[model samples]
Target: MTDTMNAVAYSHALPIDDPTSLEDVTLPVPAVGPHDLLVKVVAVSVNPADVKVRSDMDPDGVPTVLGFDAAGTVAAVGSDVTLYAVGDEVYYAGAMGRSGSNAELQAVDERIVGTKPKSATFAEAAALPLTTLTAWEGLFDKLKLTAESMGTLLVVGGAGGVGSMIIQLLKARTPGIRIVASAGREASQEWVRSLGADEVVRHGEHLTEDVKRVAPEGIDYIYSTNTVGQMDAYIEILNPFGEIVATDNPGLVDLGLFAGKSLSWHSELMFTRSVFTTADMVVQHELLTTVGEMMDAGTIRSTMTSAFSPLNAEQLRLAHASVETGRTLGKVVVTNEPLAS
Candidate 1:
């Protein structure tokens, strides 16, 4: 293996349109830790997390690579790693504090990695890791949903990456539950319906009215993917003791608003387990395994909406730009052209 690998990184927190925001560079390939797998990254997907890190975190002019999701083949395994070996196909969202998947090679913990679905291409599988993990954790873990769950779930921002996954996971995992998604645009509304949403609401001053129109009984659960200026509407339309799980932080929200209904709020962060090295980090592996099996069985599908080839600074910048627009139909993936020696 070459000592150095091609990568894209940000030396400053600048706007996506700025030419210096992301740059092409060469760095030494990361060393594999005992629990780490050295993956030859073939494809990667851009999440809002990547865009946030690029626009909000300054590295003091140091190059900070920012990619969360990856699909690749294991080039080597550390001594203590038993989950995979050389040449095993894998996909994962790497930990937050460590280097990410923007490189041609990356070292990620095996407990958080999963075997890629046999039916998917590298790009398709790459799109699944970050958004899939986020949606799964929000629905099953945060909302405490199960196969027997029955009631209505309102998914805010259902046309985005996490929302698309949330709609599909609810359908696959809890068939008895009905899903209502919010989308402002006609195309986005159709997009969520194709993914299994039973009803679609518009996001506006009339948001609560639309929810009331679709499910007059009130929402039993809410997965709030975008909660800017809409928490009041949620409280008004949610049933007593209903649960709401959010992935976005929409500034300072009044916590006391839910007291009237005795409602609860929960937040989901997919990076929590790996960043803290929790004992249940293996849960990510298991859940991802389940998702892979579901994909292979044709029960669920990939969310990839756009693709780019020959991984480099130019292609990566384009991917980040698309994600920042907040209008992407689903996930966007970029494939690596073979790295030069």
Candidate 2:
């Protein structure tokens, strides 16, 4: 193996349009840890977290690799790694504290990695880990939803990557639960509906009315992707003792909004398990494996909407641009290979 390999990194946070914001450089291939898998990344997907980190991280003049979701093959495994072996195909969302998947090779913990779906292409599989983990953790771990769970779920920004997974996970895991997804555009509305949202409504000013019209009695749960400015609408539509789970930072909001009805709020960050080195961090591997089974069984589908290839600085830049548009239908993937056309 080469001592150094090509990677896309940013030394400073800047707009995506800036040439230096993401640069092609060479860095040492990460060494495998005690429980690590040395993976040759085949493809990667861009997420809002990538955008936020690129714009917010103070790299302090050090080039920082910035990718979270990836699908790859294990080229080597650490001596203590029991979960995977060299030559095994795997997928995972990288830990926040570690170097990311933008590079040709990445060393990630085996506990968080899952077998890539046999039915999925590398680009398609790369789109699953981050969003899938976030949605699963939100619904099962935090929301404590079960197969027998019953209620109307209001998914704010349903056409998004995370929202898309939330809707499908609810459908596959809780068959009786009703899902109402909110989207502002016709295409987005259709997109969410196609993903099994029982009801679709325009977001923004009409949020309450749209939710009320479909749910009538108020929503029992809320999964919001963009929580920054939607607290008021969430407070209005949620039922007494209801719950809200969000994947994004809400910034400053009136916490008292939940007090009125004894409502509860939960924040879901897939990175929490890896970031804190939690005891049950391997749950990500379990859930991702389940998702892969579901994929092979045709119960769910990949959300990749756009694709770019040959994983490089320019491709990463285009993928980031697609995510920054805030209107990407599903996920935008960058692969090490060309599209089949």
Candidate 3:
């Protein structure tokens, strides 16, 4: 109900250590467009995209708001919005083209939003949207893996948010699929294993040896949450008809490695549908809802392992710094208060 709201924004890119990198500003509450819902943001989660946007802002462009994942209550709905109503608690990863959920309130398309799990707090729900969307699309959509398939899944960077979620979803839904995750540290190794990875290996070390130690044969599906270039050594370990899906853009990779094995390669970008308004845009809504149901059923758990209180520039900066390190065990969330159940 407030006319103005507090937000963290930047007109130019600056290093995380710079005092001006992120600023607290007051702006008029945004009005919702048709098919959009205005949300009162209670919590936000930081991803690598948020760090990239904050540190890589174009000087010539407008001041950019740089948050993606949000869990909040609906403040108002546009005239054409029929999926959600005021006071409904929802979770979503907002599109890249518009103002993001870093503000006190944001206007987001209802098609991408889903009802938050009643069993989860706002911060927990906030941690799910971005990472879950990326992992779900990478495995099921890009790689075309189904729950009925019987095979092994290898997740690189398994300790990270998307990787952790991918491991959990596959273990919960896919029968007879063995999951082998790559993590260097003990904490990360234990974290992914706890999330249902059948086996864990160190990334920088030899992947083939570690994986072979567990399954003896090669893996059937590979989801690389780390850089693609880091995956070259493991391609040969993929089965003849195996599929590899990666979200990281490592420039100029040789395709011959996969071609020889008759393997398929896929690049998954969670923003693709929202950016292009693709024919299958509603698939995101369906996936998010499914994820919420799984969460309610206790088949999957939120990846939110760390939380910062009082959503503000300093707290957001800290979260961004943590994500930029690329060593976080799970998703990091920033909330206005300790999330209420």
Candidate 4:
């Protein structure tokens, strides 16, 4: 194994176009903690959090390594690690507190790692963990929507990474729930429709009119991806005692709107459980493993829409730029050249 590896890092906040925004640096392999597994990363995926963190780098501190999702082979395990061993293929979203998966090697908690789906390449598997966890918690834990709940559901921002996964998971598990996804572009509209959205509507233009075109009454649940400001408009079209869930933190929304409709609002942050080290933290591992099984069984498919080779500074910058546009259809992954095949 190599003693030092290449990584993309940033020392200060800068625009994506700035040549110094991201730099290729060599770093020593991190040692595993008592409950950690040392993984040799083969592929990594960029998320909105990666971009946000990179763009908001501290000018005084050390350069921050940014990457959340990774798929790799376990190279070694801490003495306390029992779930995974050397040579096991695993995929996971690294915790936010430590160094991330941007390097050639990463140390992740064994509890959060899961066996990669046999049907997917490392790049494909790398695209899933973060988004899948967020979507799963939002639907199952936050909104409390079960498979038996037979009602109409609305997924806002349906073409993006989290949106795509949410649609697939909901359709696969909750067979009785009807899904209507909102997308503005033609390509996105078709993408969500193909992913099992019973209907697709244009967002930001006429949400109520479009919902009327499909189901005139109102949806039973609304999953807003990043549109907290639009919750008022959606609440107007929600059924009495219905629920609304959002992953984005749009501060200080008017609660009065939901009170009148007898609607409930929920906030879902996938990192909350991990960040707090809650008692149920292992549930993330269970959910990710379940998602892997579902993928291997052909119940759901990888939502990666784009791929880049040789995980490097330039490629990551490009990926970040795409995500910042907020219109990417699905996940964007970057794989080491040796693993891309």
Candidate 5:
């Protein structure tokens, strides 16, 4: 193989409106770290993180690739790698500081990746990792919710990617709990219901009021996947001592509001462990492996709803635009080869 490969990169934080904001280029194949595996990326999925990073990361004059979710075959492994060997099908959300998966090949730590789900296509599996980790961590690690846990969970922006996963995981793992999902449109509401939500709250309606109409005592857990700008509404609807978790950054929230209810707030960032090289970093690998097994066992389903093909600059730009709309039903994926038209 050549030392360089095709990739999409950006040198500055420009608006998606700018034609040159994301460009197609060739970059060296990243060297494998002692614990890394070199994956020949077959597919990748776009998330809000890609859009945010494109607009926020100051690349200066150096080009930086931006993508997180990926599924592919392991082409090579570092000397110290043990979890996988060449030709293993795997999936993972790449680390924040790495070159990312918007390329022909990427080197990622073995501890953060999992064996790909046998029942899923590369595109389907690619749509899962980042969102899965985010939702799983938000529900189990942060909120400590389980199948036997009692009370209601209110999922805001329930039609989006992470919200969809959260709903499915809750249904598959926590059947005993009641679920309320917030969505504005008819289609979105129906989508949430199909995913196993017990109640649907319209987005514009008063959250606290709508939640009370169902649970009467307000919700016991709040998972805000998006539109974090309305965090105050979530705080108001949460039952006293209830916990709230958010994957998006809720800018300048007033924690004092939670003080009255003795509520606990958690910010779920799936990249934290990889970013800081935490001792428990391998937990993500274990969790993803479990999710893969669950998928193969038909316990949960893939969330991929949209797809583009022949992963290139134009397709990636289109994917970014779609995610920027912030109304995507589930997940959007891009494959290295074009789908038959």
Candidate 6:
């Protein structure tokens, strides 16, 4: 194999409105670390993280590739990597500190990847990892949810990527839990319902009222993927001692506002395990493997709604624009080439 490969990257932090912000380039295939697997990427998904990274962090003159979620086949593995072997099909949301999965090849920790679902296409599997990890961690890990904890869950911004997965996973894992998703648009409301939400309400300044209309007793948990600026509204809708978990960093949030109700607030960052090389990093491997099993068994479905091909700068730019709009119904993906398998 050649030492270099094709990749789309940016050297500076620029607005997505400028097409030049992300461009095609050639870079060396990343070297494998002791626990890493070298994957030949087949498909990748764009997330809000890609846009935020490109706009906020400079690549320091080196072209920095930006993509988080991907599905591919293992081409090589580091000496200490035992979880995956060459020729194994895998999927993962790669670590944040390294070169990313937008390239033809990526080196990711084996502890973070799963065998790709047999039921999904490459593009479909690619759409899942990041959002799935986020939703799973947010729901079960951060919220300490279990099947026994079945109660009303109010999912704010239910039409987007993470929200879609949260709705589906909640139903698959906790069958008896009641879900109320907030979506203002007709299409979004319908989408949330299709994913197993018991009730759909319009998202507005009066979210508390909207939720109360269906769940008169108030919500037991609040999962907000967007609209963190309206934290007060969510807090008002939560039952006393309820928990609120968020994926994004909402600025200057005051936890004291919910203190009176003894509400708990948690932020779920899926990269924490991989980034810190935590003792339980293998938990991610377990999570992804279980998710793959659920997907293959039809217990859960792929949330991918759109796909683009040829993995080039223009296509990536378009994908980034869609994520920036904060209106995409589910997930959007781009393939390295046409998906032959």
Q: Local error of candidate 3 at 134, Å?
A: 1.0
lDDT of each: 0.91, 0.91, 0.87, 0.87, 0.89, 0.89
lDDT of 3 by residue, 60-108 (tens): 5455678999999999999998888999999999998889889999999
lDDT of 1 by residue, 264-325 (tens): 99988999999899999999999888899999999889999888887878888898899888
Model 2 TM-score, all chains together: 0.97
**Using Cα atoms with residue i matched to residue i, what is each candidate's TM-score against the true structure?**
0.97, 0.97, 0.95, 0.96, 0.96, 0.96
User: Cα RMSDs of all predictions?
Assistant: 2.5, 1.1, 1.8, 1.6, 1.5, 1.7
Please name the candidate that would achieve the greatest TM-score relative to the true structure.
2
When 2 and 3 are scored with TM-score, the better candidate is 2
Model 5, 75: alpha-carbon shift in Å? 0.6
Which has the better lDDT: candidate 5, or candidate 6? 5
206, model 2: CA deviation in Å? 1.3
Ranking by lDDT: 2, 1, 5, 6, 4, 3
Give the TM-score (vs. native) of candidate 3: 0.95
Where does candidate 3 have its weakest 10-residue lDDT segment? 56-65
Each model's backbone clash number: 0, 0, 0, 0, 0, 0
Model 2 Cα lDDT, one tens digit per residue, 103-192 = 999999998998999999989999999999999988998889999999899988899999899999999989979999999889999999
lDDT of 4 by residue, 266-303 (tens): 88888777688888777888888889999999999999
Model 3: CA > 4 A from native:
60-62, 339-341
Model 3: per-residue Cα lDDT at residue 173: 75
lDDT of 6 by residue, 71-181 (tens): 999999999998989999999999988988889999999999988999988898999998899999999888878887778999988898888999999999887789999
Segments of candidate 6 deviating more than 4 angstroms: 337-341
